[model samples]
Target: MRTLVIGDIHGAYLPLMQALDRARISPLDTLIFLGDYVDGWSQSPEVIEYLINLRSSYNCIFLRGNHDDLCLNWLNTQQHNSLWLKNGGQSTIEAYKRITQPTLQHHQSFLETLPSYHLDSENRLFVHAGFTNLNGVNFEYFPEMLYWDRTLWEMAMALNPRMSPKDPAYPKRLLIYNEIFIGHTPTTRMGITIPMNAANVWNIDTGAAYKGPVTVMNVETKEFWQSDDAYTFYPNENGRN
Candidate 1:
């Protein structure tokens, strides 16, 4: 069974569908989303609906992104915050306005239950963001570290200060993982990178909800499939906000 790892959707539903079609993903294939499923676009509600339905048709693993966390927090209290409103949360709110029951408790429950990070039997780790400590610690106690830690990601990439690939201090070796798949940070291009020899961390965020394309990568084959169209939620300089 092949595993397909997708980057942050960010409400770019059409491009996501197109990429999925291009990959020829089957119902039996394992599909893992790197989160940020909502925000940065006008179709957050539609994206959520599509994912909820897609779960029935495939082996899916959904991880919570920083944006998803904000949405759930806002939905529970109805109070707006900078993190929520500034980063496309306003668009998400607009998307929810079309629904008859905006506060869907069940949806919130699903989002809440989403794992912070996923590790396969082969020791491949998948997370929305990067972890600060590579000491084989549980991400639950350090959610922020997993969702927004750039230092740890850099250390893993540099592979420095550790003399040997087997050095326990090496971030990659600490996890005892073969590769790590992460999103949240947008890349100018769509492809894979082996940042470290031992770790092989791959970042797949292609900025679909921005001015770029959506991306999907086959874990085993390292083949990348991307949509042709450039999907964007933000308007032109003179367009409406």
Candidate 2:
């Protein structure tokens, strides 16, 4: 079966559907979404609904992103920080409003149950943000590594003899996994960056919700696919648009 790893959607429903259509994804294939599924765009509700429906029809893996975590937190407490509200949480709130009580509860449960990181038998790891390694240490605790700390992961990727470190936040891991698929940072192009790395960590976040492409990569063959449309974020007069 072909395994397709998709980057952050961030509620860009049209582009996501376009990417899916272009890729010709099928039920037999496995689609692993790297999270940040909601927020950013105006169609947060539609995007969530589409993903929820897609799960029933195909083999799909959904991981929790930082934004997803914020949404869950707000749902439980009815309040959140400015970071959460500033980072497209308003759109998610609007999405939640359209749902009935039972459906809202179900969606909350789904978000809460999402794994922070997923590792396959082939040693490929999928995480939303990045990880931290302590002295050749491999963290089996997925949640902390997946969503919270990124210092060690950044250091490992940066200092490693492989790729030239672009961001100081990138970490280096001594025990390299076969492949690591990550999203969170937005890139202008859909193609793989840090290609010189021996560790095979691929950043597929093409910034679909912003001025960039929505990327998808075939894990086994290293084949890539992207959406045609480009998006950009513009701040309004009040610093929100």
Predicted structure with the largest TM-score when compared to the true one: 1
The C-alpha RMSD in Å for every predicted model, in order, reads 3.7, 4.9
Off by over 4 Å in 2: 135-142, 160-174, 189-199, 230-241
Model 2: per-residue Cα lDDT over 1-241, one tens digit each: 7999898878777778888888789999999998887777766667777888999999999988887888788888898678878878886787678789887787787788888877889988888777765322245445555665555335445565654445454444534566777887655443443211234567777776565556777888878777764353223211123
| Candidate 1 lDDT tens digits, 1-241 | 7899998877777778888999999998999998988887676777787888889989999988888988898888998987668778887777787766744665676788888888898888898887765454373456666776555455655665446766655455345566888887766532332112224667777776566667889988888888753444344311112
Q: Compute each candidate's TM-score over C-alphas.
A: 0.84, 0.81
Each model's number of backbone clashes? 0, 12
Q: lDDT values of the candidates?
A: 0.73, 0.70
